[model samples]
Target: MIISQQLDTKTDHQVQAIPLDSIAQAQGTNIPFEVCVDHANFVRPNPQKHVNRLRSDNHYQGLSSQEILNLPPWKDDFFYFSYYAGLNGTGFMGFEAGLWSLSNSQSKSHDKCVDKFIENHRQDQRNPMTQLWIFNHKLKQIQWKNNKYIFILEYRGKGFQVINYRKTAWDLAQDQTVWFEFVDTKGNRLGGCTEGWTCPIRKK
Candidate 1:
């Protein structure tokens, strides 16, 4: 969905804050693990378009191997997750990552089906690279405000990271949020993009 159209036109300082429960209720459901998998599996974009977009985007272009390795998990790890999750008819990309993190860190049950799925696709045409980060931290919280799903993640030493996923008023496609951010507990920005590719950290 187009985040710009979904947001209130008020200045950043004047934006209203709504509770997470209210936002989830209005949106119908929290971002379920199943939904993330389904979208990754069933929805297919043109391979050429995908490759070209990756090549053309300034945000992704001109990066060294070390730079790519050190990039944020969302950018580096999520790319492979999206690729592998979409490989088979089952979409388990985001769910697998979440489960992997939970299983390793919190002793949660790791779904065997997810592991087998990844193994089966290991040599597939779209060979997604293995994720460097296990994303051991679970989502600290998820809130909805101004037509966005605000995902809060906690890292051991990183304080807090906030991701805002927005939706449009009339769009039917259940797509991922194009704009997101990583912020700290005090509302200080760590990293993220604003509506028009503006600096969310600076804007905050």
Candidate 2:
């Protein structure tokens, strides 16, 4: 799903795993979540009451996580709704650039629009919400633009990230589908990919 257009001056965004502090510290604000849980807990017959915090946060992101994954709230997951001030207006991470690679669980990353960011709570390796995502598009959050990274995403463990070009961050009218996070109904979005409550959507 990674769009490999002719790399030119038009595309200046670099995919560097830099520290989130230097780029967004001055402008972007990282609003920490009061309640966070693993993606595994959100399964059917929810485990804890605190799970709602996770469910609702994802639901608030335009579309609920369970719904996004095609898992209805009744069977595949629980039903919940919530509001978090920290997640206000955080839009899609479909920065409009991506390279869909292959992984095990979901599907053929290449054929489908998914990144292979895997996780295992049982294993020491976990996919914590890395600032690398928000950092990659630091300019979006800092500049005095209406569409910028208002809030960071609430990803729990590491998973594959598609190639992010970040062109849409500058031009909203552009074809957002070029980005790997593009959902058929929601356009380019990363909100449903996680437990939500935060994403890099467009807003003033």
Candidate 3:
């Protein structure tokens, strides 16, 4: 049997509360539960929770040493919702630019995007790219913007980076589906193939 939960949004804006047991019995015990909020205003209710405090102060609060590969698609994707302040730490390296690439779990391959980037860069000064991704703490989505880096080897191979001011710090969160690419010296992101949040949808 399919159980439908209806929420009333008239005047008061009320949610229908039902027993979790009833819903679990209707679906199977082995299957995961899906909570669907039918229509969202897309309005953020709390502002304080979205702040990334680590960058605000010189001190840091370390992120849990999460195994990036272990999480489910949706949960893994939610890493975009977090702030990787550690990228600006003492052990941090310099920047790299990259073309947007898809995760292994995604239908497309990162190599395809990499190849396209290589092809595009062959004629221009920007060849041989690096990939980067970050968790957006506010939006709760993985953002590819400002995270990718493209490097030209012959230009200036070795150099040091100083964090004079973090312009990209404490920005809004981004969704993973969108594509972006750019190269910068100080803030260009690093790393390839990051884990994001798990999918909330149920398998039919």
* Residue-by-residue lDDT tens digits, candidate 2, 1-204: 122222122222223432222222232233222111111211122223223333444443464445443423221111111211121221122211111111222123222322221121123122222212221222122121233332223332222222221122233344332111212222233332222322333211
Count clashes in each candidate, considering only residues at least 3 apart in sequence or on different chains: 1, 18, 30
Instruction: Give the TM-score of each candidate.
Output: 0.32, 0.20, 0.17
Per-candidate local distance difference test: 0.30, 0.24, 0.21
lDDT of 2: 0.24
Compare candidates 2 and 3 on TM-score and give the better one: 2
Q: What's the alpha carbon RMSD for model 3?
A: 23.1
Best by TM-score: 1
RMSD of each: 16.4, 17.1, 23.1
lDDT, candidate 1, equals 0.30
Task: Write the residue-wise lDDT of candidate 1 on 1-204 in tens digits.
Answer: 000012221221211123212113354344322111111112112334333333453654685544433333322221212223342312223322222122121111123334533563565323222211213122444444445434444433211111222233322244444344544455554554432211223211
Model 1, residue 45: what's the lDDT? 21
Clashes of 1: 1
Regions more than 4 Å wrong, model 1: 1-137, 157-178, 193-204
Candidate 1: the clashing residue pairs are 37-91
Worst 10 residues of 1 by lDDT: 1-10
